[model samples]
Target chain A: MLQKRIIVCLDVRDGKTTKGVKFKGNVDIGDPVLMAEEYYKQGVDELVFYDITASSEKRGIMIDIVKKVAEKIFIPFSVGGGIRTLSDMKQVILAGAEKVSVNSSAVKNPSIISEGAKHFGKQCIVVGMDVEMDFSKPSGYGIVINGGRTKVDLDALEWAKKIEKLGAGEIVLNSIDADGTKNGYEIKLTRMISESVGIPVVASGGAGTSMHLADVFNEGKADAALIASMVHIDGYTVGGIKEFLNKENIPVRI
Target chain B: MKIGILNYDAGNLKSVETALAHLGAKYFVSSDPYELAKSDKLIFPGVGEAQSSMKILKKRGLDIFLREYFKKGNPILGICLGCQIVLDSSEERNTKCVGLVPGNSKEFSHNMDLKIPHMGWNQVQSTNNHYIFKDIPNNSSFYFVHSYYPDPDNQNAVIALTDYGISFSSAFSVDNLVAVQFHPEKSGPHGLKLLDNFISKTQGV
Candidate 1:
């Protein structure tokens, strides 16, 4: 059976791993490359690094951090933030990152998703969607861009469908409202998009405990869960979380 | 021993290179048949769609070189796209591949109630005692990310099987040639061990 994945997210700013509460007031934690390798050693299934400052500062993801992580951690990892063009995707992949994610940039120009998928296989392309609850929107959720600083009028469900059609292999559904809240994943929103798309959906943001992951995977029907704070600062080990999920009958790589 | 990593316009070739460097093995990346011919063993690591990859292989004459190399009974290891293109045909782009293995690549059915690109880690069960799986335990999880899988016409060619809505061949072996649908280079410690086993097999251990 295909096991449900547990991905540890590292939000890197200026090469150091940082974590913010709902995308605000991020505190420097540690070195991203070191944190990545440590998480890999702790039996994490995959890793995702978001260059938090790239999009706002109008710069590329720190390639050196990517290269260092690749050399140390031998697992499938993705690099997101500040990826705008096909060349950016190429540079990240060639530097040894398995996948390149485009979130804010994909909203600005949807063609980059198709072009990246065409140039590199769709398997290497990931589309990250930062969504916030909005009763006014058709899907009851609106898409936000530029690291959640700018809210687009686009409906969340519609954007999810569009990106899958545009050749996005997977969708990382991050909830702005639930982000860093430590409550749980956006089950209603995550399940809505998961059922709507044919591609794999990774539920991101607001993972506080192992039970939360169990809820997302069982109730939300998420193929994977992207977590940060639970394991980053809450003193939860990736192995411990997977053990709990395994006990709960969720198939996780232990 | 010298190992040649076939570079015929595939994506993320650097991961394989770094894996080899980490193992302290002598390896080179080349599309030229002459350079690859000099290798004691060949590691075909690929990431892309089959149709375009096959086209590039034909243009660089790597398709012929690989076919001839397999005929000579030299050890060859195929990973991901490398594993699929070794088959005679593929459902992707209806591509006719290298024909080294008696099989064809197939796309997972959408009607099966599963994701298209089955990404992430899953258990790969060893079907038989092939030297390639030497020290690797049975049902060990490896990273996978593909919609299509290799289905060999000959059942004996299949060395391992995996389940994802359906049980399918995840690894195949034909004499000196072995191939797997998962990426060993990106699969962490166990994956590195698998690559080391491949190297040990080439050394006749």
Candidate 2:
């Protein structure tokens, strides 16, 4: 049976992690590598790093950060933010990221999806969708890009189907409507997208507690759940989340 | 011990190199098979299309080199697509593979609901006390991402099995050769240990 993955997300700006990702139980936490190592020790299934800086100079620095983190963590991790071309994707992969995610850039030029998938197998490309619920749209959700600054004509469901056809290996569905709310995952939206596509769906955004993650997996049928704020700010650790999920009959890699 | 990490300019080379470095094991990554000649053992790791990947191997003359390397049978570990290539042939793009093991690689039946490339962490049940799994725990999970699996003509060679939609061979262990459908370098501590096992055991033998 495929185990439901609990991925820890790190928001890195310049070279350091944006906000201090503290582990209540562990005191040895300062840098991204330390935090990542702490999570790895707890057996966090995977990790995701978003290059919040996204500047040309900072991206080169981010590559160094990726290399440092890769040296410490063994599991697979994906790098996103400011990944514009095939070379950008290759840099992260060579620096040791197993996958590269594209959101706004991919929206602008959809060919990057197929081009990337062709250059470096479909497994390497992830189409990350930031979706916002809209009653005006037929699917009740619209694609948002540029950090929710712009909205596209594409319906969430239609885009989900299109990205899969374009040879995207996975879809990371994040709800702009429920993001940073500390409520729970948009189960309705997640389920809708998860069921609509053949590829795996990673439910992201709006996770406040471990129970919220379980809900996404059990109800939304998400192959994986991306947790950031809940674990980052809240006094939660990856081990704590997995332990909670395990009791709920969600097979996490404990 | 000196280890040869055979790089085909494909998947997980850096991660594998990082894992080997963490182990404090002496290793080098090179596209040239000749570079691996002086090493004690080899790790064949690949991730990508089987058809195109096979062409590169033949282009580099690695297909010939690997077959010769296998005949000597010191120790070589094939990972994911690298593992599939050790078989007789693959259904992927109707590609012929190096036949180190008696088997053929077949794509998992297109079970639409279940993901085609079974990508995630999953349990691996050890079938026999294979040396490659020396210190690893039983029923431990390893990371896997592949649509095609090797159906070994000889079932006894299968060292481990994992079920996605059905029971499939996740790994095979035969004399001086071990191949896995999962990525050990990406599979965390247990995975690192599996590589360590392959290293320590191969050198001792």
Candidate 3:
């Protein structure tokens, strides 16, 4: 059976890993490459590096950072934020990243997902959606972009189906409300998207403990769990989390 | 020993290059059959669609070169789709592969109650002693992300197995042909150790 994945996200800005409270008022934490190496050494299943300012700054991805991390760690590493075109995807992939994640850019063009997927193959194209619970939207969650500052007409769940239909291989459903709260994942919302889409759904935000990771995999039916605050600042290690999850009868890559 | 890697505009080139560089090994990345043939060993590291990759290999004349090279008992290792391409055919786009083996690459059945692309780290168990698993512990987790796996005509060729709702050949070694569905370039420490084993075997060849 496919073991549940535990991914550590490195929010990078200007080559340094930064942590923001709900995507706002961030602070520099550590070096991106060093932190990635440490996490890799700690046995994290995968790594996601989001150039937090790349989309907002309207620039190409930071290829140097990606290369540095890729050289140090040998695992499935995905890069997102500010990826706008096929060339960007190619450059990132060629720099040693396994997958190129598209968030704000996918919403702005929509064709980026299809085009990127077509060019790089769907396995390399990951659609990262930042969602906020909103009754007005069709799926009860509104699509937010630009680090959750902009709202789009697309409903979260509907847009997820569209992204999958557009050939995106995987989805990172980040619950804006659960993000940075340290409470728990939005299990109900995650279950909805996980059940609806055929691709692997990575439930992000509000992962406070190993139990949260277990909940996302078992109850939420999520294929993977993306954690930030817990592992980032709460003194939780990837090894500790996996050990805890494995003890709880959860199938982890430990 | 020299390592020649086939690069057909695939994404695994740089990563494999990095891993080799870390091992302090001399290697070259090229598509020219002549240049790759000069090396002591070869690696066909790849990540992309089967159809386009085969088309590119054909245009570069490496497809014919590789089929003959491996058939002659030359040392070559194929990773992920690279391993799949060594097979006779692939379900992906119904493309004909290089056919290093008699089997075809099969798509994970949709009704298997499993994920299409089994993306993550899982334990791989080697059934017999092989050079690739030398000094590596059994049931070690390696990073794997793929939908299709090779169904080799010769079951004896399979040296390692991993289960993902179904048991398949995670890796196989036949004569001089070696291939793995898992990306050894991205499987962390154990992967590095496995690569070291391959490099050591090619030391005096």
Candidate 4:
């Protein structure tokens, strides 16, 4: 039995850790290196660093932060946000990110996924999808990009399948509506995407409690759960989630 | 003593280096035949297509060197693709392997319910108590991320088995050569312990 993974997401901006509610109302959290070390101590299975800064000046500085975090943390680290080209992906990978994720760039130029996969291997390319419920659409969920500010008008499930075909090793399915809500995971949306794709699906957003993690694993059938606020706010430790899942007979690293 | 890590231009070398450092073992990342032969032990770690990796090995003449080294009973450990390459051949690209183990690697087609790659932590059932898992607890979880696995025909070659879609060899040992499908570097404390065990065995501790 494969153990379920608990990943802590650190949204980095201007060389500092920050978090936003539903991709809005950004708030400063702390230093990325410090936050990453803390999460590593708390037994996080993996760490995700998403660079949210909107300035070109901060791009190089962000890679420096990734280098700092990767130097100390032994677990797998993934870096995303503003990764537009193969050079950008290579820089991050060279900076010590086990995987590099592309969102807007992969959507605009789908070949970037194939290119990155070719250069760094498919296992290192992660496709991030921000999805929202659209009542007019038959699939009900539409793809959102550009930090969840723009709608692509494509079905989220369809896009996930397409990216997998494009050679994305894994899919990080983030629910825009469920982001920062702390209610629970969007089971239907996650399940649809997970079932539609053959690769691994990581469910992100709305993980408020330990039960929420279990709910996503049980209902969504997600390979892993990505939590930012819950762990950031000290609502639950990664070890705590693993313990809870272990008690519930779910395989998780403790 | 510097442990030689086979640099075939693939896989997680840094994480493996970190794990070795945590175990307080000094190692060198090398592909040079002389450096590899001079090292105390060799670690062949990889994380990609077998055909591509074998191509690089052959291009560099590492294939002949590794085959000769294993025959001398020099300690060698292969992780994931590294482990698969020790077999007679792989279904991947229909390529021939080092043939150190009496088997061939094949893709898991028996179970569709279980996902391919078998990524994440899974427990291993030891076939026989070897020094490699001395301090590691039984039923301990180790990180694994691979699609195809080697099915060794010799029962003595298998030292551990892990249940995924089916019971498969997770670790195998035949004299000085040992290999595992899991990544001990990424598997937390248990992983560190496994590394410690390997180092202790290498040092004759």
In the order shown, the candidates' DockQ scores are 0.89, 0.83, 0.72, 0.54
- Consecutive 10-residue window with the lowest summed lDDT within model 3 chain A: A53-62
Candidate 4 chain A, which ten residues in sequence have the lowest lDDT sum? A67-76
lDDT (tens digit, per residue) of candidate 2 on A1-254: 89999888887776767643221122222467787888899888989888777467757888888999899988999999998999899899999999999998988999999999998899989999999988788899999888777888888898899999999999999888777777989999999999888889999888988899999999999999998767666789888898899899999888
> Chain B alone, TM-score of each model?
0.97, 0.96, 0.96, 0.95
Evaluated at residue B25, the lDDT of candidate 2 is: 91
Q: Write the per-residue lDDT of candidate 3 for residues A1-254, one digit (tens) a residue.
A: 56889999988888778898887798988888988888999999899998876444433436888888888998888998878889889888988899999999998999999998777778889999999989997778889998899988889888999998998989999999999988889999999999988889999999888888888888899998998767778999999999999898888877
Q: What are the clashing pairs of model 3?
A: none
Q: Identify the superior model by DockQ, candidate 1 or candidate 3.
A: 1
Docking class of 1: high
| Tens digit of per-residue lDDT, candidate 4, span A152-239 | 8788777888998888888999999999999999999888888877788899999889999998999899999999988787567787
| Predicted model 2 interface RMSD | 0.9
lDDT of 4 at B151: 87
Tens digits of per-residue lDDT for model 4, B67-147: 888887768888889999989899998989888888988898734776666777788887788888887888887878888
Candidate 2 Cα outliers beyond 4 Å, as residue runs: A19-30, B202-205
**Would you list the C-alpha lDDT of every candidate in the order shown?**
0.91, 0.87, 0.87, 0.85
Relative to the true interface, what fraction of contacts does candidate 4 keep? 0.41
* lDDT of model 2, residue B169: 93
lDDT of 1 by residue, A1-254 (tens): 88999999998888788989977798999988878888999999889998877444434447888888888888899999888999889888888889999999999999999999998989889999999999999999999998899988899999999999999999999999999889999999999999999999999988998999999999999999999988889999999999999999999998
Would you estimate the TM-scores of all the predictions? 0.98, 0.96, 0.96, 0.95
On lDDT, the candidate that comes out on top is 1
